[model samples]
Target: MAEQPETIKAFVKLGEFLGDYCQFAKGNLEFNEDQIKWLHKLDDLVARAASHNGWFTQGNILYAFEQWSTALKTDNLKKWLDQYDIQNSNPMTVAIIMAGNIPLVGFHDFLSVLVTGNKALVKLSSNDKILLPFFTEYLTTLEPLLLGYIKFSDEILTDYDAVIATGSNNTARYFEYYFGKKPNIIRKNRNSVAIIHGDETPETLSLLGEDIFRYYGLGCRSVSKIMVPRGYDFDNFYKAVYSFKDIIDENKYANNYDYNKAVYLMSEFKFLDNGFLLLKEDAGYASPIASLFYQYYDSKEYLDETLKRDADKIQCIVSSRPRRDHIAFGDSQKPALWDYADGVDTVEFLLKISNNN
Candidate 1:
């Protein structure tokens, strides 16, 4: 088994490498000769990645790298690992079935498996094929002991003791039926929402635009719905998010906007439009791309009860008031190493797998 501390060291180095690579992608590299050549290859890799998935714009992919670079810092990695007793004398191979909605979406599971001294048998999503491979190259090169510990396969997954599968609610039924015999963590579709107390400054609402438009609203962490005070006006909100009007310029997003808008119009659904985004009074959590669903609330008590009742469907609650599991505006996508998806701790699950073996 790879030593846990050594694995952490390798990831710290990887974080630094990613930081430098982000700078290179931003065209700020002066010259490192051999390293520059490697970065050029990565630049091409980013281009190919974008080609594979139109939603993966350069800015979004680079933002993913930047977030991972920050999360994998020496102190951050150490702090996250400190929470787990990761001395696995027997390391189990964990099968990770990932989703490709965003760049490197399956990485936390991959990282959890390896960081806990377990082998990772990964099944990459077709939409996000190249980004993780680049990280695999970096990590294995940094630590040769990890060479066999990490594996990626597109074929049928086999030879794994446990499973961690992420997919839509419909696909989750298939995963449970197939992988139910093994120790598993299965996740389904969940969306985030925001609460507007009608006290936010324009600057704060501007930051909320990042939560809405970043990644073109494809990530589960993206805010798709918001709860506002009854009779609340949205003039300030629209003005604040005007900075993100460029999002409609993306062809895929624009298509979604046009198609969904046409359907709403044909159906005679009352929705507010601002040329780039649609604000609809919807009680539903999931909203179509280029649209935001909102509901009116009368009291804070009702809001708390509603959120608690629908905890299973909510990923993150973007609010200014600090509370348990609530994320601030613009910060939902930038999760820490410990912030497990679906609120299930992946490290703890993998550690138990090692212990059981």
Candidate 2:
């Protein structure tokens, strides 16, 4: 196997290839014969990924590619890895249980294991089955040394030195029971929220709409709730997000809107509606698709305390405030390489385990 610097170079090349693939995907790249064949296969995957999981829309899949292309730059990779003391050591088999919420949801974990020189035993969620394996194959082709370092399995996870699993709250209990004894990073359901200060520009709110509607709000990074100042009007918020109003035209989204609306009506619950989106006064963080739950906060101090109190349940907090923990508006989906999921440093964990082994 190659050394650390060589591995990084190979992955950087993989990033360049993905950048080209993204352009090819958009029909903007002049394709050579090899590029044409690669694009055809990638096109097939993008076309059919959503059929297995309706939430993995074509646009969302492409957006994922765009984000990753930007992220995999050589400078980005170096900066992300610079803070950690990565070393050459015995490779441990790290089993990853991927979540199928959005396209490539478990990619950060997979990347963490491999980039830190560990073997990845990936069990894909049936919802997101095709894209990562295809990417892995591409990676191995770029650097043949990766052939033995990556694996995909459908059987029960075994022979792993450490574990990383993402699942809903209920499934977490099972993971804890089965893999609790091992070094692990297990993630449960968490949602993002936006703190609206009542002075946000129409443009700002429009960007926030991306944080909400991206991937149909299936990603843990997607904003499902908003905390607004008391008596904040819904008119501007509704108008700003109207750009995504056509989302209701999609059959699955329309069905969700119709079904959720009927349930709210039957239950005699009061919720504000702008024809396409529903807004309700709810204290919960996880909101169903087609609807947004909101709470009215009195002060920044209160909002800060409330957020800190429930920090374990939240992912990204979208705000313009200059707090260390808050991510700027619209940036919730574009996490940097070091922005570890659940705030756990996956790379550091891998480095530590690999060094010990």
Candidate 3:
């Protein structure tokens, strides 16, 4: 295998190629109009695959590509590469246990492995098998070197240098038991939450809709619950989010929301109303359906404490506060290239493989 520095350069070139692919995919780069249209057609194919497999809608797929492009141009990927020492590592094998909550959710793991010259044996979620194969096929065309390194299997995998697994809280216990013997990055289901100060603009509130409803709210990064000031009006927020009502028809999601809503209302639960949403004064972070819902609190201090108490179950926290880089309300599933999932630094993980350390 090549030396570390040489390997890093190769990975950097691959990153650049992937970045270019995104532009081509988005029709934002210069190309024959026909070619651009064809590229977008490919995007549609992937979107259809996602929908058929119960992954997400077409809009969410486009949003995911947008975030991927942004991260490619930004310092995220470069920073990850440098921080992880991608160029100097040894040839390693990486086993990836992927998630199906959002479009291309497995892409980051693929990028990390290929850039660092590690072979990837991927166990694709039953809900997400379609898109990853299409993506890998296209990537192979772009860089023939990767054709053999990326393999998909349904069987249990072992004897790998490192492992990255994503699953629900219950499944995580099984992952830890099975894969924990190796250098592993195991992820459990964690909900994202948003904090509202009762002063958000309509546009901001509308964007929050994207955070909560996108992917039909299946992603770990999706904002499952919200924290709003006590007595906050639901009318303004509902009006802003109602525009997306057309996209909320995932039967599984609607059923969940509706079922929960009926239970709350029949039980005579106390909830604040904005005509379109319900704000129940609950203690937990997960929300029930039949409501564009949130848990109301009297103070930010209490919200902070609640979050802290459930830190292990929480992932990204969205806030308008300037200090936090939390994703906007609807941008949770649309992660940048460097936004490593499950809080694990993927590039650094790849570097360990490169160095055989």
Candidate 4:
């Protein structure tokens, strides 16, 4: 109960606004004088973001908004923060380096810094430059006190006590070399995978399509590969995912599909094709867009051991098994507030550094 109620209240109010925006986002929203202009501005932002980044489609942006709307509820916030004993700490500047693969991928880090009574100095990915600043504006409108706590930087980061950076394997090395001296959480690339047994129903396979295709498989949580039992029938899997074949209608995605298909053909690598998608028999976990790599497993025991051994490279396991840690199929994109990326707790990291300072 030591947590500030006003901060929580501000986020809850912002969540209500987002929910309303998602419901009647096409200029039909009802709001007071203060929020009316902001709502209009947000509508403009959706258009601008889509135009700025070809991968950030309007549907994906709206989906991100709706997901954040549901995640920012009072009850969910309380439950997520309940595990920690929050105490007053000297305010320090925490620099955040965000990723742009999917929409608003860095909001969690921004929220973690500000909610834990620290200032956030964010260096946004060029690919996702607009959404977070607009969100910060909305939060400051709700809680004027937060006006000083959030900042966006276009220059080299400086004057921060700690850093939280997310990027691919290459940038992670750079982050480590530069921010290693500071208290930091540097994240590298990790992809998700799914396990399939022969007995899955069509509904289960179809639902898995959402996991693979949402945000065009740009998210780290998206299933890039699958592990199936020996003699698995892919005809059923292809049929289940046929409904999403229209994904090739998008120009960027179709381009990638075509490019990758040509490369595979030129290399003379064998892969299965369904016009819109290519399935390859490979051992790697990270598959390119419009392509899925799969590996065959002979036994459940060996598959479990292999997954456990390579857990660090994996983000989430989508499976029908009752393992406590596995994410159920189709739920990978809908992570709860407590599902920390790379399994490293952000709140705890912030609190530890804050108390030390």
Candidate 5:
């Protein structure tokens, strides 16, 4: 395994480069000659990534880069690593089957594998093939030792000591069947929900719009449902989210909104529409894009009980209330480095696999 400090230093360098590039791209800072050349090249690459996948809009890809730029800071990496004994693990190749729900959605798993000194055999999602490989190649330029540690394969995955797979519920069953005998973390479909109060101001609800509209509500942590007090008036909710009305301007988002709305109208189902988004009264947690599923809750206790019962199907709860389990409004997408998906400790799993090997 490469020395731990060297790995951390390389990651921090990548983070700094990302941060600087972001500032330069936004015209907030001037880059040096070499940086200017490379950044202009990066601008072209970002456009190529957007072209490769319509969902990977330039803005969303940059947002993902900016988020990870902050997450990979030296202090943040140190703090997260301090939580476990992440050293001296016998190197093992980890096979990672990633989902392409959002930009860099599979990156945390990639980071977990490499930071723990484990080689990664990653099968990049077809929709997200461009960015991760670009960055990994960049990482090798900074730290040559990482060259052999990272492998992206479009063919069959083989010679892996452990597995980490993420996909929809049906694919999860297949993953379990094939990888169950090995040390693994197989993540299934999960959705996030928001618990809101009737008395809350529209200004507050507007912030919740970020949770629903960001990434077109495609991520597992995106709020797919909202539970409000019984008979809660939605007038303010509608007005608050009117600020995000421009989302309809995007071709893909508008197509979904138009199609889903047509289906609801043809089926004669009752729903609230505010020109851009749909609010349907439903019991399900996973709502279609451009729509939010909502339910009426009579009491806090009932909400708590229902949430507890549906824990496995939920990734995070969005609430303004003070609860350790709850993420603040608009903050679900900004998960910390330690916020492992499915509540499974990736680092610990890797350590165990290493020890067993």
Candidate 6:
């Protein structure tokens, strides 16, 4: 069997595994009454498991599985693979450093390596090691052959054909310094933002809550800030977003919000009024809070310039205007499998690895 055919076979096997996983997710994991009850019980166990470490919480566990299942759909995986000519390349090893901000944030990198027929040496984040193993355990059960190719390591970072690293601006600098010599994708601190005109309805704003608050505003895809017209009243926005109050009870997230809020108040910084959150107008694109951070623009021209000036740091721009392909409020975090970050085609990157080998 040629390498390309073997690679294709692996992808087909993965697709079959994903199909089963999707069924399990939708039927058993997500909407199942029995499973929901089990999840509640599992939450208690997870809380106990991480009690000393102070890392994992019930919400984190739930969201981790939720994202894992969402990304595991057969159609989504197949769609991502379609863009590449995977049958041509036979990559040996691909190094990936997965991000830890959101649950299963590294799944896309995992998919890229798997579908492209490369052995994956994953450097899992300390904050996210537990969940990745859970996902791999399930995969092993589905297709034991896959267990041979996927390996997790805490140490032994090394030279590879290619690498992918996601991190903050400060960390990105270090990644570039270390991994820049290799064919690599080093992602810097970037964020999604919204462009809101006054005409946005309450329903739309509520959906935006999913973009802003889901995973407690941790994911890079999660909207960290908004661009609004000056003097915009936030009464409707607050009313819409109040439904997510439950997120505040999630220990780490609540602490983040409270801590940032306290720091702002203690420093006596002037911020725009949003009732629930203080929108500090700043020159930068990203903000600190788990809440929605926003900048006010007096005119459309100013908004355009602001976007252009910070284009490199911006990820997705959600807006009601039909001008751009801006996703709806809740849809930001739920990116389709085809959606690539930093304008880089992940499948293409993987294909390059396979082809170069």
lDDT of each: 0.89, 0.88, 0.69, 0.90, 0.89, 0.70
lDDT of 3 by residue, 183-225 (tens): 8888887778888888888888888887777766667777768
Candidate scoring better on TM-score of 3 and 4: 4
Looking at model 4, residue 342 earns an lDDT score of 96
lDDT string, candidate 2, 58-141, tens digits: 788888988888888878987888887777568899999999988898988988888888899999999999999888888888
Ten contiguous residues minimizing lDDT sum, candidate 3:
1-10
Predicted structure 1: lDDT: 0.89
What are the RMSDs of all candidates, in order?
Answer: 1.6, 1.7, 4.0, 1.4, 1.7, 4.5
Question: What's the best-to-worst order under lDDT?
Answer: 4, 1, 5, 2, 6, 3
Judged by lDDT, which candidate is best? 4
- Candidate 3 segments whose C-alpha is farther than 4 A from its true place: 1-44, 47-51, 74-76, 248-252, 266-268, 271-279, 288-293, 328-330, 353-357
lDDT of 5: 0.89
What's the TM-score of each model vs. the native? 0.97, 0.97, 0.82, 0.97, 0.97, 0.83
RMSD (Cα, Å) of model 2: 1.7
Model 5 stretches astray by more than 4 angstroms: 1-4
Indicate the residue-level lDDT of 86 in model 3.
42
Residues 1-357, candidate 1: write the lDDT tens digits: 223477888888888877888998778888689788778888999999999899999999899989989998977887888876678787788899999999999988988888888899999898999988888888888899999899889898888999999999999999999999999999999999998888899998888999999898888999999999998889988998999998888999999999999999999999999999999998889999999999999999999888899899999999866477788888989999888888899888887767777
Instruction: Sum up the clashes in candidate 5.
Output: 0
TM-score of 4: 0.97
Residue 115, candidate 5: Cα error in Å is 0.8
